[model samples]
Target chain A: DAGVTQSPTHLIKTRGQQVTLRCSPISGHKSVSWYQQVLGQGPQFIFQYYEKEERGRGNFPDRFSARQFPNYSSELNVNALLLGDSALYLCASSLRHRGETQYFGPGTRLLVL
Target chain B: DQQVKQNSPSLSVQEGRISILNCDYTNSMFDYFLWYKKYPAEGPTFLISISSIKDKNEDGRFTVFLNKSAKHLSLHIVPSQPGDSAVYFCAAPDTSGTYKYIFGTGTRLKVLA
Candidate 1:
């Protein structure tokens, strides 16, 4: 089966602009989560949605938000982007909300000027 | 605070030798840990995972060892291959019982032929 898939493999935005990245979970998966990875650092949790509900959120600012659809797809939106927001945004899916392995997508690389 | 940490920024090993990557976590409440491998421009792929109840878990040429008292974990790849060269990250679930994960800074491993 196809793994988790993300859209707009690459993006470029300016400071104060807004951007949206999309992700589709694996078939039969109900949980989706978003993460951000800067150069030389590991992925940082951003938001997690299970069955279309916000299950958890990370320490990111209000500029970052995400939501899951009934089909288990998710979108990550960043408003008023800053240069510090430039990074790879990753999406992962799991079969359940807890104690399950999460499969990841190729991620969308975003650059903010 | 960085709940998960991989102090070693990189490692080099000869092919057929063993590659060991270490990780340390601050929260004792974290009972499950996972290892992931990532190539440039791609999302992380799950490698292995271990529960706090177990000290060691092995799969194929990969092994994960957990030390609860030390709050440390390590991933061992026996007879490392060149394809194993990549950034490896160790992660643990959020302490808040959400599906979110806390990932380490990652250790880049290069297996030379």
Candidate 2:
């Protein structure tokens, strides 16, 4: 089976613009989560959705939001982008909401000028 | 605050030697820990995991050791190979119901042939 997949592998946005990244969980997976990875740094948790319900959120600001669809796909939305938002946005999926191994996607690279 | 930390920014090891990467976490609430490997332009892939109930877990050439008293964890790759060279991340799940992961800053490992 294919691993988790993400869309628009690369994106460019202005400081005040908004961007949306999409992710499709591996088949049969029920939980999806979002993370932001800055250069030379590990990924930071953003949000997690399980069974299409908001199950977890990270320390990110209100401008970052996400949702999961019935099919277990997810979308991460960032508003009023800042230069600091220029990083790889990764999406992960797992079989359950807790204590399960998560597989990740190639990630969406967002650059804000 | 950085609850999880990989103080080593990078590591270089001979191909036939063992590669050891360390991580320290501050949150006592974290009960599960995981390791992930990532290549350039790709998302992280699961390496190994250990629960609070266990002190050590091994898979193939990889081994992870957990020291609950010191809040420290380390990944060991025996007979390291060039393919094993990549950024390694250590993560732990939220104690609450979020099911989210807190990640370390990552250590870039370079295995020399």
Task: Write model 1 residue lDDT over A3-32, tens digit each, in one string.
Answer: 999999999999999999999999999999
Candidate 1 per-residue lDDT, tens place, B80-110, comes to: 9999999999999976767689899999999
Measured against the true structure, the TM-scores of the candidates, in listed sequence, are 0.98, 0.96
lDDT of each: 0.95, 0.94
Measured with C-alpha atoms, the lDDT of residue A7 in candidate 2 is: 96
Q: What is the C-alpha lDDT profile of model 2 across A1-113, one tens digit per residue? A: 89999999999999999999999999999999999999988898889999999988888999999999989999999999999999999999999988788999999999999
Query: What is the DockQ score, from 0 to 1, of model 1?
Result: 0.88
Worst 10 residues of 1 chain A by lDDT: A94-103
Q: What is the lDDT of residue A2 in candidate 2?
A: 96
* Chain A TM per prediction: 0.99, 0.98
